[model samples]
Target: MKTYQTSHIRNIVLMGSSKSGKTTLAETMLYEGKVIDRRGTVEAKTTVSDNTEVEQMYQRSIYSTPLYTEFMDHKLNFVDTPGSDDFVGGMISAFRVASTCVMLVNAQHGVEVGTEIFGRHAADYKRPMIFGVNQLDAEKANWENTIDSLRQSFGKRVALVQFPVNPGVGFDSFVDVLMMKMYKFVDENGTREEYDIPAELMDQALELQASLMEVAAESEEALMEKYFDVGELTREEMIRGLYLGFQQGILNPVFCLSAKKDIGVKRLMEFIINVAPAPSARLEVLPDESTLECNADGPTVLFVYKTALEQHLGEVSYFKVMSGKLTEGQDLVNPETGAKERISAIYAVAGKKREKVSEMMAGDIGCTVKLKTVKTNQTLCAPGVEYVLQPIVFPQAKFRTAIKAVNEKDEEKLGDALNKYSAEDPTITVQYAKELKQTILCGQGEHHINILKWHLNNVHKIDVELYAPRISYRETITKVACADYRHKKQSGGAGQFGEVHLLIEPFVEGAPQNNRFKVDGKEMVLNIKGKEEYTMDWGGKLEFYNCIVGGSIDARFMPAILKGIMEKMEEGPLTGSYARDIRVYVYDGKMHPVDSNEISFKLASRNAFKEAFRNAGPKIMEPVYSVEIMVPSDNMGDVMSDLQNRRAMIEGMSSQKGFEILKARVPLAELYKYSTTLSSLTSGRATFTMEFLEYAQVPSDVQEKLLKAYQEEEKED
Candidate 1:
């Protein structure tokens, strides 16, 4: 390998839907660069990029694998990202680190969900994009139809940069519009060769060339004028303007290649090295609050986008150097924590292999070792720099399930395994529910958790169990009631005796953040906004200063009484549902001189809660999430109708690239299996991401059904 002074570096990430040939494409590129002796297929489980034990079994790229090749006098660092939506976090992380998105598509499938998934990301980041139609050598592959799908999915701006001379079984070469020449290759063993355009295809090639020039001319006002005046443009002018357009995201060039056969990869490599913008050429970001710009020579600031746990090898910290040169053995301040650490070692990562580099210049991607305190999304920069990149936000877990290891001994190991996995993948969060008493694992879908399980057992050698997560439903009262309780349990010589009376009502979000206690045993009405109030009697040792008129209740003993009432809330009234957000009014109560302990007051408070809950109407609250679903416009009616049946409230709808974007709020309970259902309904076209929203009351009938199910399950247990 050799280095060049006029060196060019391309930070590109290969992204697309599964089986779209992303991993195989990386394999082809490595083979083309002679990095590997033999190319590995996804079927044979020998690909370098998908080397993970789990990925090998599944035959997909489940993580981002960084691989680079020095070719065409340029160093291209390719971040091969996973195609499965389960690992979408990897895809997004790659996009944030890369300046270009090389979106791959299956020639036969055209623009499938995988292509569309990464396409949205490329558009969002405003990154330059190039489409590669892979598997062109596969039987019955149609290049033109794939281009049409791209046009339908993207727009008319999608132009052919290289045209395949022979497609499907006959695929052998491609015509480069820029060079105006044809290059041929035999995919049988992926041998490079040269070819002239077939005479019969010359006229079509000329027509495509005309379209290409027109697009290139439209890239700039001056070029447009030149083309209209002379009816033609020089090759230099076309190439220069087209490169500008692509760099500016004004044009998306479609290139052809068969990663399986490695045809057209040389041209693909050349385009990446020549067309992709250099590190300095791309934009550098700065905090909105700061005046300092991101400078390579300025104090170094690197954002750790991902971290890996390497068993006995400590940790591997992968970061994006936003500015300044970072060399091994140099110390820099952590802009986040203000702690300085000597750069231990710097290396370019490929799969699990690390290639030691003495230095990683500005805009270069690499990894370092043994950073104890750092994790994913942490900022590591010069001391006192006080700069931080925004956190890597992810969509709320749309699906959840109870996860328990098969053996009790694996319980702690399960937690440890999840912690390690979470360190690598920030999107997956595992939490223990105290009330549900289950280790709840939240993720994108069932397949998402399944992949984690695969990684856990095989990669980390830990077995785990999984089941549907328990629903966290809260119980509340509808009507207002008040009652008094007198505890007369005399197990001790002093005896346990206390009398308490209290009133309970619903609480709202705007209720005072401060908790106040008043001991005025008076009558107060429970009023829900925009609804009538139920006048109820207040009687208890507990007193609730629930936004009532002044002098309504006394202040003294109210705290103790409220504590008693709180004990009841912790236990619940009808079902032990941990009653949430309820106001308890303790008007008055008599304490036994010798027996009124906290236990007696608690018992008295419990009775009062039951009385109030019976008088006041009770309702159930379920969690809902704000969801935005992106689907093709044609599926709008079907989606809306299906959502309506699921009790989804559509906020609005909009059109995007032949797809309908639906914004709606739906209860979490109805969305557990939505991924599978949406796939079935749209035949795998609709995709959605959801975030936690406010809780809403469940309708009476639905609540009854849910309650019945819960009660039946309880009985079974």
Candidate 2:
């Protein structure tokens, strides 16, 4: 292997929907570059990109795999990403480090949900895009419709650089509009035979060529002036202008390919090496409102974009040199953790195989094993000249489930396994929901969680079960009620005696006022004094006050009473849920100097608070989420109706790129397995995202059922 300069390196990411030939295209690219002797297919589970056991079992990609090949004296680093939205974390990671994105579209299916989703992701990253209309050899391949769909979905900036001359079962050749030549694949061995474009399709090819020229010319003043004067651009001028246009996202050149049959792949490789922007050419925005250029002589700075665990390799961290060169045995400090790490070995990774490299130049992607403190999204730089790169922002987890080890002894193992998986993929989150009393595992969708479970069972040997998570319902009071209790115990020599007279009322956020109540046809006015509000560590607040007068109770005992009340609030009287947003007023109490201790006061306060809470209007509150669903226009009615059935309130509606967007608020209880249901209803075309909004009171019927269930569980326990 030879080391390449930053100017000769091309960092590209292959992105598209699943089964869209991204892996196949990657395999073909490796073969064409002589990095691999043979091409592997997805069906055989031998492709470099989809090498993981989960991916091999499912016959799809689950993680992004980095593979490099040298073409035309340039190093082309290809990050092959998963097409499924369930593993969108991989795609986002790839986009973060890559300078260009080659978005592959299935010719048979044309533009799909994955294509649209990743197109938006590429736009979000502002990465230059090149469209590859793949699977030209498929039986139902439609080149015209696919190109038209691409143009319609992505605007007129999509200009054709190549087109299949005969796209069908025997698809072997495509006309290159820019070169004005026909490239024919003689066989499956990737042997190419060049010829002049056929006379019949010359007009169409010339028209596409003109479109490409117009896009290229409009990107530069010199090119535009030359085009207006001479009505055309020379081949060198066109390539230069198109390269600039591509980097600016003003031109998205579409290339035709049959990755399986090895048709037009070599041409695409040539285009990448010739036209794609090098790492030094791409501008990097810095945190100090300045731009950092990729310079090999500058201070060392690398951004870790992906992390994975191999069978014998421990933890392999893949990173891109953002500013300076990285060499083996170099010491760098992780700015995130302020920990120093020494790179023992550097390897250029190609799927599961790795080639040890002494050094990697700036803008090159490589991996180092066993960095104790370095993790994904961590920036490693020289110790003295410290700088942190922007980390990749992953999407929020949409689907969640309560997970527990089948055998209680393996609970600790389960936690360790989950931590490892979450470290590799940040989109997968594991959290202990104390209020719900369950360990919740959250991911992009059901498939994502299932893969994590598979890893847990097969990789870590920890068997676990996933169930619907419990809703964290809250308990609150609506009205005011007063109760008194006396704790009297004469078990031994010393007696325990304490009496508490407390009034419980609904808490409001403003100034405390007198609470009026009618007791037995008598008006009773209770004045709040010295109110103290303590915010609960979990959520909500506990309001307490000492309205004691005339030495009714010692001031020191008020803290003990409040503590007792909080203990009872932790397990509310209504249904054992945490109580919140309630004020407790201890107006009077009696204490014996010898017997009345903290225990007696606590017991009396707990009993009195429980009695008053039950008498007051207690209600259960459930968590609500704000959901935004994107679906095709035809399925909007069905989706809206389904949301309404879930007791969701339709907040707003809008349109985006031929899709209908529905915004609503729905209770978390109603959203169990909703991702699976939404897929079934919309044929896996609709996508949605949600975030926690606020807690609202549960319906009366739901509250009744929950209370009954809790009571029954308590009895059984």
TM-score of each: 0.89, 0.95
Q: Write the per-residue lDDT of candidate 2 for residues 1-717, one digit (tens) a residue.
A: 899899899999999988999999999889888889988889999988888888999998888889998889988999898888898888888887788999999999999889888898889889999999999999999998998788778988797888888898999889998898998889997899989998998998899889888888998998999999999998888898889989889889999988898888888888988988888886677677577778898888988988888788899999999888898999999877889999999998899888999998889999989999888888899888778766788998899899999999999999888888898889999998887789999999999998888888898898899998988888998888889999999898889988999988888778456667664466776666688888877678888878888877888888889989999999988788888888888989898878988888899999999999888889998889999998988899888889988999999999987888899999999999899989889888898999999888999998899989999999999
Best by TM-score: 2
Model 1 segments more than 4 A misplaced: 1-7, 186-200, 287-295, 459-463, 489-492, 509-543, 546-556, 593-599, 633-645, 705-717
lDDT of candidate model 1 versus the reference: 0.74
**TM-score between model 1 and native:** 0.89
- Model 1 per-residue lDDT tens digits across residues 108-168: 8898887887788788888999888888988978888898889987886697878888797
- The number of clashing residue pairs in model 1 is 24
lDDT of 2: 0.88
Worst 10 residues of 1 by lDDT: 531-540
